[model samples]
Target: MFNRRKFIKTGAASASLLLLDKQSFAEILPRQKTGKEQFPIVISTWDFGVYANKEAWKTLSKGGRALDAIEAGARVPEELDITNGTVGRTGTPDRDGHVTLDSCIMDEFGNCGSVAAMENIAHPISVARMVMERTPHVMLVGEGATQFAVEQGMKKEKLLTPKAEKAWKEWLKTAKYSPVMNVENGTNRPGGKYNHDTIGMLAIDAKGNISGGCTTSGMAFKMHGRVGDSPIIGAGLYVDNEVGGATSTGVGEEVIRNVGSFLVVELMRQGLSPEEACKEAVMRIIKKKPENAEKVQVGFLAINKKGEYGAYAIQKGFSYAVCNAEKQDLLISGKSYY
Candidate 1:
């Protein structure tokens, strides 16, 4: 149904492997294999989170490093489920009931790549990997990305899932616009600055090497072609071997503006723990008042290379499903970190 080689060719290649500027990969290596070889890898998807922890845990357990495990794990949601609407085969439809998708991947070495406003292609994140490793560019979008996919022989297929179609059909019956918390309307009342178009994953390998990636079906009831932070480097996903890796879900725009993922990693680099960095990043966005407001809103999740992790949001409660190297495990860090 999909052109694996065509998809693979979309990426830059030098000597069999997609060349992702070895310099970036070099920054995270010397792959430290800990004595705890049998430990499990963790995967978390909170309240609005998607993807099963087993999807990724299995890959890591098989000796795949964080990046491979994360991508392999993420590909499951991108290919099978429809509820997530942000990653996988069935995605949330736009106001018109058409599905568009976006995705990104970042390696611990700081190499980042993405694709956005995509339609027809099932695995945009894999396409994004091609852009990062095959081409000199970090992103490709819309028809351009599709054309590239086609040129490389990637197949085009229907992206809408039955469940998402049902959702749009139902929403159409009500036509009620929910008053989402907007980041732009900081002074008066908060409104949603960005549509939620993201599902993210962060992984640390047994050696402590790290990687992160995000994918989305775009925002629910969004404009037909709107793209969000899920496909932006440093915005949707970020990783640093010296620090850690992070990815965000909910409201892509605020995440982009805050440079959410990178900010968390930087905080960790500055001595804040993984959880502390995540809390600070969310608070930074929430405390922002544009000369007249109450509270800003945003949400994010993070994991440092040390295997520590955390998540935070401006709302009351947020939880992400997680599968770590320890076994089938889940973590819901709760919303409001004291």
Candidate 2:
């Protein structure tokens, strides 16, 4: 009762079905998108980015430039006195109890500026923009950056808030300095939950121009004068109007070693989706230091010229905010490697 022809036909049909199933499964993965073009979209790292995106949308929805939108977005967290001790003036201080800030801004024309280890400035993002607009340099650091900020008419104030001071006092009791993974998103520390850290934002304007900005307080209780990737172009943030923009959060050292954000944007240029590109960037970090990847968290958020966006992280609890015409105040949990 063996019919070779019938058996072969059935086998072919089964194989076709299996292939179709595989394709279907792939389509449902987090990396897959419809590839539709979205204009005037803003995306930023962390749930706090929800507020930041809303601020950016004010300019973006009004047909403003991507550069302006991102600057406006980044300033929201810089002025907030949140508990995360991540962004802005109230951030957790360095080991010696100095609250230094780092920030960078990039425009659609490849012009960028940054300030690192700068103290006493409440809005470092604005200072960074001034550096891009007024200076011949790409970065300013330490006392020089503080002087520049003051020269530009920004006031110097004590950035350490009462809450931050309390936390620092508590941390000094233990004096244990270890980077905690996912500390930003509801991670319980000795004092309380650290809400978030490091806000990196990217926006696409109605004219299809792309711009990005990154601002951070650096790591909590870090060494004095330590400047993380946030203030380094092509490390914490990169934007190409013709390609896209990418930003990163978490451990800046890991991000800096791999030029994390630039790699994500470049991967998108090579025809990968934003999510796929972000995943590849994270994998590169893991491949370089698999052991460290397990201990610390690093996440990348990217958007393509088409306005399609995606994100990947080394650990869970990394999230981002997205705002567009269709969706506003949306918080998306990033896909993680772990």
Candidate 3:
């Protein structure tokens, strides 16, 4: 909306104003780099991330690769839990009592691997690593994924624990798919935050390399063979050594639709801080379904190349864990639309 007649009347003054406006506009352009981040950091998607961060820190503290730290951390919830196994062995199963798992791993080199709808494995996160290191494929699914896990000498174990099975059975009595609110909080009740979560971990090594891992049992009581966003790269988790890392929790379908994690990193690449990047990603989802934005929950955790991090959620129940040399903080992210 340039006004040529007004500008001509103003003459020299108008020219100086135009030059100043251009200079100000140039200052607002997105920066390509945010500078160096602190080394050896781990962040994850829930209270469980406190434990995951511990595992990730062990490796990072010793100069281990970011990928190793992330894989080790993501496997913790699976190896130690029997009740409400959200990720790894003993996870909640599909509607038909099938305990399928999904996981993905990504390294700083852009190399990645994944498994989807896999069954009977206790450590889908480890199996996913094996896929990344031992196979030529970027992803494996169903029986094929299981076969690979066994081939890697990973034992097939019943992933459905007594507690998880009990929950599933009780859920079947009603078969209601209602997702509850307050997901950004610390409550672990039925249909709470735990019901729609993944052990999604990200790490930055001492050398500044970044990696991420995400593992889940799919949605609680989802239809058999359902594969959620957890095992899908750029959806559940994404890592870029040059940009940052991001992971998602809550509704997987929404994450997949917007490629949530990837969006966060891309925003970071454009000079947004990790916190603002997460907020922008959440806005993308809200813009997609403004009418239903408050009805479901989705949260994103992001860490920039400089080790700075932040998270945001659609509701108030989204919490995460962060660890560095200072300490581990289990913090609830900022709330949104809901």
Candidate 4:
């Protein structure tokens, strides 16, 4: 039953919600006495986005700003205590047994920030936002990124939890790199599990401001000092006030090589629907590496300035969560090209 189908049609909607410090929710989406409202949306990658979306919903429900909402959403998994260690403190460490984090943030303005190969700090998304607000630099990395986080009053603490330590020790015995699929939903398999998912969120406030945030611990057992597309501006995430926003998950290499998120956004500007843009980006990756197209997974989630949103993936099981005033918690499985 591997790769049962290539495309599975699903419902479509636009998403994004706004959250700012000391902001409150407003009637951002279209509304009627009994008609459906479709603005103030929040959509993100994977199933865990359900929880993350709920946290963001808290802000949007109160009419908070969009950027602040996404920051709150991105921190859910980063601060979560989990056995999979997908993000933040409990995330799986590198081959050298170091827990590094990667994250990025983008706002309605051209302002953006990122941190890569960071260690000993939790909530890289928050740090990324700080970088966007406090400094002229758009990114910081390795020791420098860590130093900046500490200097910004971020807690300097051990990121590798005891469970992660035990897993790293066990992995050292095998030291084999065999990537796996669908491990994020809970399965015992080799290759990689903790890296099977990411939180790529996009939100729009009442004023039509778009914002995005993406965070991950990166692929499990990766080489030391490796930074993936998660923290890369145009690769893992992109936002434009005039057009829309997009965020990616799955294989960072394929995403980075093709500049996936940016591609999706540009396509939106070129008059393509969010779904079409995402599908085209997936096809571009396949066209470049047809041989490995089915071997790895890459999915893109996008939201436009009008609040329209869509997602597409290279394989089955890629899903996203959407929420707004019309709805609170809904999970939608996107079509795949496997």
Question: In lDDT terms, which candidate is top?
Answer: 2
lDDT of each: 0.63, 0.82, 0.75, 0.79
Going through the candidates in order, what is the number of backbone clashes in each?
34, 0, 7, 19
What digit string (tens of lDDT, one per residue) describes model 3 on residues 222-248?
A: 888888799999999998889989998
- Report the C-alpha lDDT of model 4 over 187-266, residue by residue, as the tens digit: 33122333445689999877778899999888887899988899999999999899999999988999999999999999
Evaluate candidate 1 by giving its C-alpha RMSD to the native, one decimal: 13.4
- 133-170 per-residue lDDT for model 1 (tens digits): 88888888888988777776778989776666666777
Of models 1 and 3, which has the larger lDDT? 3
Superposed by TM-score, candidate 1 places the C-alpha of residue 202 at a distance from the truth, in angstroms, of 0.6
Give me the candidate number with maximum TM-score.
2
Q: CA lDDT of 34 in candidate 4? A: 24
Residue 69's lDDT within candidate 3 is 90
Off by over 4 Å in 2: 1-34, 187-196
In candidate 4 the C-alpha lDDT for residue 113 amounts to 94
Single out the weakest 10-residue window by summed lDDT for candidate 2: 7-16
On lDDT, the stronger of 2 and 3 is 2
In candidate 3 the C-alpha lDDT for residue 177 amounts to 74
